[model samples]
Target: MLASTTTTTQISSPPQQKFSLWSPPNPSTFYCSSQLLSKPNKHSQKLQYTERILDQATNILSVLYPTSTKTFSNKPLASLKTFIRDFLKKSKTTFSTLQLALLYLVNLKKSFQNLSFLQENIQLLSDPIFKCGRRMFLASLVIASKVVLEPAPKNIAWSKLSGLPITEINNAERLLLSALNYRVVLPFEEFVEWNILLHSPTVELFQKINLVLKKEIWEGKSNEEDGPHYFVHYQGWKEKWDEWVPESRGLKMTEENLKKQKDLVAAHTTKKPEKKSEATAPSSERGKKRKSEHVDTVDEFAKRVEIKIPIPEELKIKLVDDWETVTKNQRLVSLPRDPTVTQILQKYREHIINNPTSFNEKEGLKSSVFQEEIVEQVTDGLKLYFDKALGNILLYRFERFQYVQLKEKLNNENNGSNNGTEKLGEATHAEKCMSDYYGAEHLLRLFVQLPSLIAHTNMETDAVNVLKDHFALFLQWMVENADELFLKEYEHASAQYLVDAKNCTS
Candidate 1:
């Protein structure tokens, strides 16, 4: 096998963007807050206004978007006016002055009934990745309208209104979602918050906020309008909109491309210039050489590779309590594009743990039946069975481990996460998600789930017994509750062989 000399290097560094909304407006700008220090009357106007302002001003705007980052860069009012002009010239989305003013009052309630308990609180956005601006607000409006409106306009329709391409619009939506790492989801509370932000203010004759984009005049698409209009409304008007995406998302010539790639890989992995004389030899005679050449070529890019060692029929390796055959198959794998093999492994693992594929139900239970075994009372025979069982389990589990670790790393390289922000040719293929499969917290929970299957390789003793018991019950539940294709089949196959390690059932 050829040596693995794969290497990669990172050549660029850029400053990161910090999350920010709009800075506060006036010195006496009353920011809302749900003061936790002192108990406040639930029905008071202070509570409503405080929660409303903070909810919007803060990055956790669940009333609008479920996942919003913490940012101080809010200009929704100005953006709102701009948006209304461009899209809702005749639509009912425009709000009247009285209605809008009432909304401001609700959003900015003066402390009444409990003036002594008034507290100044602000939760500035702290995410280091989210940068909210006009584009973000416009995107939010398009998304939130789907939640609030009975019949929302299609995405493409908003493209003309917002002066953005559908792809750009979708990219903006995706960016907002990814940045909103930590968010608050108070359904009922958010309802009240949104109400107050609109027109449910407890105060009367309050001044309406001038919903103007700072440093910008209205560029709304309108032909009929009076001078200095305060309100904009949308009548019941609809237009035909097409939602067709550009060409095919995937290349139609995949088979041809795949074959070419495989051939290239074969050539690279087997580059030893074996004499041409052997090419004329019988196929059986050249099999070993071809296999060796293939391994040699791929080894250049592989971190590790496993090949099963052929065992003679007369010689069997197993434990005294085992009854199986076929043994010793393992190896390693990595990539040449990363700076180090370790970095490649990390990326591979991330792809596998994150990318989920649909498993076929028929394949799930194909290996459920026990492997054929020879019943031999001799001590050596039992020992051979044990070794074989262990080897089979280890080989099967390791193979699965490799696949699950590098699953999505196999995707076409063109589809990357840095969609909207990429410069002319500065494309990137970055990890888009990191989900903790913890489904757990605290020390006790860690002990409960026991992490992935790799952790149970040499497991035994009381802990092993506990895991077996848990496994049996869980397996029973799965065979009862889970869809056939949903459960990971490899895990089950490995577990069955491990259970047969003692050959008790055999």
Candidate 2:
């Protein structure tokens, strides 16, 4: 069923004024509407900033390691922080503190001519990336451990000084290893160590016991005809070092080796599927067939469902009033009747459990039937409410839970659909059907739920598109509108669950 709405007048803002610290002018501040704020703009900005930092670090490394052939650059690296101020300025976004601290660390590293001297002193405090100080040190150690003599020094005491559980440090070590692509040689540390070793032990030993050891090199002099050895001990070390560290042997680059590396990288990298031309009969025909299939499926389902579910008018009006009251006070609205909602939701769960679909028997039986049922019931009920225009306002508050759950289910199925041809196609079709059906259903649900009428709105298309375009926005709205006190408790419990998972995994 198509969920359509009538629009109303747009909410106008006051005239612009000079910017001030107290009233900072930004889109995030001016458009406090949850609908407007739900767009991926903020998230895109955050990703962009992360890419920029990585790019900057890559450039710094390239400068330091000019001889290295490896390159580290991504296309979207520079566009990472355009609208970041909007989100970072808000105190509610806890990641801002973590982002700032990370930036500070990066800046400190860039300032140093050589990071080796400052390596031991570096420590991160409850940073989001590391999560704790021990994690931070462990991540650094994963890079620098080879250079330092007492890598995990007892005197440093990670547990006591960092105040982190030993388990978290271990987990962080694994994460860092994965992030660095398991390249144990960490070129930066290797280079730093090579420099130190060359100056102290290698050079001094060669000079002291020289048998025909180029005395002119120590006298701060050089001859043009002295050949390659006069420049540096490149050949001598290249020969000796290979024997000393067999793992580092045969490291010379050649045309064949270069081609092999390129081929391997190309094979591993994901290639975008070729898009079919609009004129192609197969692509056009498939689109038409899909549309007809959806229409037929929906029509048949509607016809079978002869009973019209009765919605409580009093409940609808109460929800509308509650939504308005909460929005006015800049607070999230609680579920009107939590026990009643929960009970109705539970009933729907039973319906799904008792009624078996072929796919459900194989897939649903493997998962938490209770959780699956809860999600299905919640989604179906919300769709019903939206189709009837019973209570658009309150319904928006719970919309996100449905979107997240559906997306997660689709992702899980996609990952596990490789068993057989019949199962594979069925899984793929099921994922697509669920995604598109729920997406459209949820969009229509939001259209009916908005406080303002959609009919006469100035930005009618924009408003409609807002509901249709982004599911993430709906999730954000649900979190914002849901009861804050309950949400805080839920989040705390959730965080604890994550911490417990980390502990178990460790």
Give the alpha-carbon lDDT of every model: 0.28, 0.31
Per-residue lDDT of candidate 2, residues 211-306 (tens digit): 233442234424454322211222213312221112123222222444676698799776767677666778768989966644443232122111
Clashing residue pair totals per candidate (backbone < 3 A): 41, 10
Candidate 2, residue 277: Cα displacement in angstroms equals: 45
| Model 1 / residue 218 / CA error / Å | 26
lDDT of 1 by residue, 1-506 (tens): 11122211111221221100101011101111111112334234323332333223321121112223332233233333233333333222312211222232222222211234223212212322123344545545544444334455555665656655666665554443333321211132222223333321211111122232211112344234422221211211221221212213222222244467568879868856566786547864688886654343223212211112222222121110011211122222222111222232233234323331312132232221111110011111212222222211222222333333333442223244543454211224352211111100111111121221112122223333333333332233223332321211112234653444323211
Worst 10 residues of 2 by lDDT: 20-29
What TM-score does model 1 achieve against the real structure? 0.20
TM-scores, all candidates, are: 0.20, 0.19
Candidate 1: regions farther than 4 A off: 1-86, 90-132, 181-186, 197-506
Give me the displacement of residue 161 in model 1, in angstroms: 1.5
Candidate 1: 10-residue stretch with minimal lDDT:
19-28
